[model samples]
Target: MTVLDALPSVEHAAVLDESSKREIRRAILTAIAVPGYQVPFGSREMPVARGWGSGGLQLTLAIVGPDDVVKVYDQGEDGGVNAANLRRLIRRSEGVETTTDPRQATVIQTRHRVPEDELRADQTLVLQVPVPEPLRGVERDMNELRRMHAEGDYSKMWVSLYEDLVRNGVITETTGYPCLVGGRYVIATTPIPRWDVPPLHQAAFLSLFSAGREKRIYAIPPYTDVEPLTFEDVPFEVEKVSARCRCGLVVPDGDLQSYQVEIPQQDGSSVWACSDTDWCTRQRVEAGLLDPSAITETEVDL
Candidate 1:
């Protein structure tokens, strides 16, 4: 039996036909050519349901090859149900190798988080987006939304944000914050936390966003400007993790703060742990701080 026939139904669905790959590639090229612009395309069949990262899977399948190393993560976890299943599908369907390490992956498909590591120039980060429209909150009418986007009229969005600031004392949005890419086109930053948002601004790797249900694809090319929509007085800030990690590491500024997760303790209180388990283990290994298993004689440089 062939690889396609041997696998289960879900994996079988992801093994896209050649025509679908070509159409996805065409959409990708168009998206890259016009940064932050949501280019519409025909959403093809994939294993996952509409809102469950089918778009990202399709994009990865179109470009990933046998030699490529793929990684899929859901909220920074490599072993989560979603991540594990998707990674298995990609590997089994295409015969491409898979890795949990961000450093080793050529294309990293993510559900709602970006890797904490500084992505290399050669890598491509594909973010799965449930909602691709940044202005949807401000404008409900599709025709009017298109017209506003075409005319670059974001006055209502600015007003809405101002109202949010007035009522909440801060921009209350925790994820899917809107951002201006390439100094034009205010695009939704795909449910990534405020912490993950900064790396996308002037980063080394290219970022692709796909919405399977929405049938749209968009991109932020390498080294492009990505500015969060905020007031001059109210500068954008990431959520802070104040507690020390059980790994004997203190919360370091300017690096992967969003990767921190709160762990409940024996008491009613809780502590913080780095959600990027690989990075945390590496830190422990390198420092010789606590865990010996995570520590090896030689370490791989991130």
Candidate 2:
């Protein structure tokens, strides 16, 4: 049987323990009532490294059921070492099916990039955040940062960015962009590509950001305000690609290119694919955009 066909059918009760479901339900309710507050829970130790997607796994285990389809991606690709590692853990621990199709997934755990397509309201996107503090650079003490946030003191962050612009012609930030949620809470939206930032603004889905090592959890519920930290004159800008994919279709507006060596048996030919492997596979299937070395003609013309 094909890999897809060989997969076992989901059985809800078999997937989630009663205790896990109760814990997650409580956390979700607490998150909603407190708004921007961080809710600490008994985070379990995973077989993977602590800094990896442990935070995502914790949240997933809490909410995932036997019947739910899970999708995990790192830098947009399912084949990335980190994504593959997490997928194995989930399958072994929970026995839920995994997929590359965004439409089929009920839960998606991602690092550094968000899917190019708009997420549905029913979907839950969990981000693996390395750091989740907007005031972390200035105040090393969590207590001090909390006070700064309480007083709405963000002038230091603005000044730092201004100085960065003076030194380098543009804002030198490449990841871990800070944003304001509900116009009150200054939250770090994690390292998602700037291209995906706009989608988080009043998005339809629930966006959860967690830093396991740092011991923090934050949320941006549907229809909430989320704006990138920017000055009035210097508006926030998403990344741009100068060239389209050689496959003839325009790369998803914010998709980034990644390189890998492929040795073809014929003459040791090499080629590259989307860095976000899961994203690329979905695009390939849905849009019929084939890699130059894989096929002769465009499989499906966009």
Candidate 3:
């Protein structure tokens, strides 16, 4: 084939070829068929760097169509640098409509946090995963880890949590809590804080996770079971925040101050304003704090 036929045209940089997308779609279907099972795929390198969400972009490219509306978020904000760049890239390639509103999106690609709004049954969520294996820290070797997964040998994982409970008086596996999926494989959601984990349990929308660097993809279908590992007596608990947002939204307040103190904001304020930029802004408008027309990307800094 000629060079022109081999590579994608600059005009169509956002969308992959039909055959390539079909392969990814097939892999995604297989993953969905077998919930919590990590299916390996031929992860392509995108223009963006590896750590900046190449996997989630690939899934978006494969599933996104001209008619579908997409929303991209990093740490619950779509206006952030990473999310904006990815959204631009996707738009450039597919010429698809994009939105900050979660309710309007057909597909939502997110890193580190799920949207604060309840996702509908028809919506699809693509999660960018840094590490898909829940047993990675416990067993470094891939072969041994696979063997452990096959044998359901998660004793090491359980022991670690038990130790944490013994020392801290609570299971301190806060974010990326190792969860048992479909009562089978143990999979950890990528560093999404504990507050977001509960939404995954029997969620209405289909949740798909892709780790591009790791070359693994997994899915949790709508209505699937996702239970965080914890003893019956010592039940799992989410991180609690002390205060509500000024707009009357239940947001992380004092506890978040500890973690967000290091992040320098554009206005020199702390990053504890709102985790979900769109949600917070909507709440503000609903509360008549700001006019709908005044809402802009820069107004709310996540």
**lDDT for every model?**
0.85, 0.71, 0.82
Q: What is the Å distance of residue 36 in model 2 from its true position? A: 3.9
Each prediction's total of clashing residue pairs, residues at least 3 apart in sequence or on different chains, is 0, 6, 1
Between the candidate structures 2 and 3, which one is better when assessed by TM-score? Answer: 3
Order the candidate numbers by lDDT, best to worst. 1, 3, 2
The digit string of per-residue lDDT tens for model 2 on 70-107 reads 88988777667788767756765677788766788989
The runs of at least 3 residues in candidate 1 whose Cα sits more than 4 Å from the true structure, single-residue gaps closed, are 1-14, 252-258, 264-268, 289-302
For 119-227, candidate 3 gives per-residue lDDT tens digits of: 9999999999998988887889989988898888899999888888899988777668898889988888877888788899999999999988988899999999999
Measured by TM-score, the strongest candidate is: 1
TM-score of each: 0.89, 0.80, 0.88
| Model 1: residue 256 alpha-carbon error in angstroms | 8.3
Question: Deviation in angstroms for 254 in model 1?
Answer: 8.8
Better of 1 and 3 by TM-score: 1
| Models, CA RMSD each | 4.5, 6.8, 4.9
Worst 10-residue lDDT window, candidate 2: 293-302
lDDT of 1: 0.85
